[model samples]
Target: MKKILTLVVLSFTLTMNAFAAQKLDVEVNGLVCDFCAQALEKVFGKKESVKEIDVNLTERYVRITLNEGKEIADEEVKKLIIDAGYDVVKINRVEE
Candidate 1:
């Protein structure tokens, strides 16, 4: 019984850690120029929890990484990108 309990606790901790390191891939429209990309970066960069950001101009995708145990809502991220003078086509949470 003790062994089983230990395993259960370990499993829960691992699951929570996995969720904490979640990364999201957001695809946006009208990301045609450097200025527009810069704007998007600026908005997300301001977030304290954001760890890294990658922008693909050709694919019009923005990949964002949040610090461990940190996450920004989809709507909030989308709104930030939209406010930067572009349209958020879609936001998807990438699987690890």
Candidate 2:
């Protein structure tokens, strides 16, 4: 009975953490080609907290999915893009 109880609590905790994960939508300038998208993907994918990255060149947007209990600041996002030779035009937190 104790083992079952512990398992139930652990399951609930994991579920809640998944629900608390963060997502970000960022519009960037100069994301004009597949190579540019690949560069952004490589940058964001290297972060341990980043679970997923999706870039749409047509829409000039980058969507980032972060693990639970982790976050990247707007300034940091801008800096990352800038360092990768792009400019961030807008950033917004995506509600889960």
Candidate 3:
């Protein structure tokens, strides 16, 4: 009975971790126009981890809300931006 109880608690913890929401803010360079923002939105929109994307051309930043339990590495974000023909100035986690 004790073993079963322990197993249940462990499973619950793991499941919660997997579904936790997260957000990231990335400052970028060369976001000069709405078209550029659209290009970036299109690129990030396809990512499974990305639940929402908000691009501010005037602020030169992209805010991404990650799906529950999904997280992205800084290097991967930088690479994705680079792949989309943009330059990443900085990337940081948005503390909840």
Candidate 4:
């Protein structure tokens, strides 16, 4: 009975982790046009870890959804955005 209970708990934990998503909202500065948004999307979209990306020019924020069990470090995010000629104001991570 104890073994069965443990198994059930473990399975539930694994299932939850498998479905977990890592979302990152990066507030940026210096993104001026549609072209800039497209460039940002292309840069982040090339990463296998990134599942989806949304660029909001009005707010100057980039939203990135990471694939299951995948992540990009905060420093790397900052570096990439900077390399693309944008300033990183903040990186907010949401786990779901």
Candidate 5:
């Protein structure tokens, strides 16, 4: 009975996490080179809340996937890009 309960709890936790994750597509300006992509990666990749990051220099966008039940506010996202010497064009919150 104890083992069954533990397994059921673990499964529930995993299911909740899978459904709670969020993705953000942040369009940025002034990303002219590979160095800029690297810079964005460095800044966003270190955060525990960020599960993954994809920087596209050509599209001038950064795709960030936040960990379960975690989020980065619009203001903070804009601030980070501005501080990195880039301009934030738009931020779209994508819920899955």
Candidate 6:
């Protein structure tokens, strides 16, 4: 009985940790120029959880990766981009 209990506890702990390590992707809009891309980089760079930020000018999108288990809400991310003088038309999560 004790062994089974220990296994159950371990399993639960591992599952939680796995969920915490999840990552997400986001898409942005109104990034039609180089200056807009630079501005986005500056704003996202200030986020502690932002591990990487890739901007595609032609597509007018920004792909962002956050630290393991950390995530910035779509509204929050949009607000940040908008604050930098750009428009966020959409936000999408990249699936693994």
Best by lDDT: 4
**TM-score of every model versus the real structure:** 0.82, 0.79, 0.79, 0.87, 0.77, 0.72
What lDDT tens digits, residue by residue, belong to model 5 across residues 1-96?
A: 999999999999888867686999999989999899989889888888899999988787899999887878899889888988999999998877
Per-residue alpha-carbon lDDT of model 2 for 1-96, expressed as tens digits?
A: 999999999999888866696999999999889999999999998998889999998999999999877878998999999999999989999867
lDDT (Cα atoms) of all candidates against the true structure: 0.85, 0.91, 0.90, 0.92, 0.89, 0.77
Candidate closer to the true structure by TM-score (higher is better), 3 or 5: 3
Per-residue lDDT of model 3, residues 1-96, tens digit only: 999999999999888767777788899998998889999899999999899999988788999999887888999999999999999998888745
- Residue 6 deviation, candidate 6, in Å? 12
Higher-TM-score candidate of 4 and 5: 4
**Model 5 clashing residue pairs (backbone):** none
> Where is model 6 more than 4 Å wrong at Cα?
1-25
**Candidate 3 Cα RMSD (Å):** 2.8
Return whichever of 5 and 6 wins on TM-score.
Answer: 5
Cα shift from native, residue 23, model 2 (Å): 0.8
Clashing pairs in 1: none
Model 1 C-alpha lDDT per residue in residues 1-96, reported as the tens digit of each score: 999999999999888876776688888888888888788788889998798888999988999988877878998988888788888878888655
lDDT of 6 at 49: 79
Native-vs-model 2 lDDT? 0.91
Give me candidate 5's TM-score against the actual structure. Answer: 0.77
Candidate 5: worst 10 consecutive residues by lDDT? 13-22
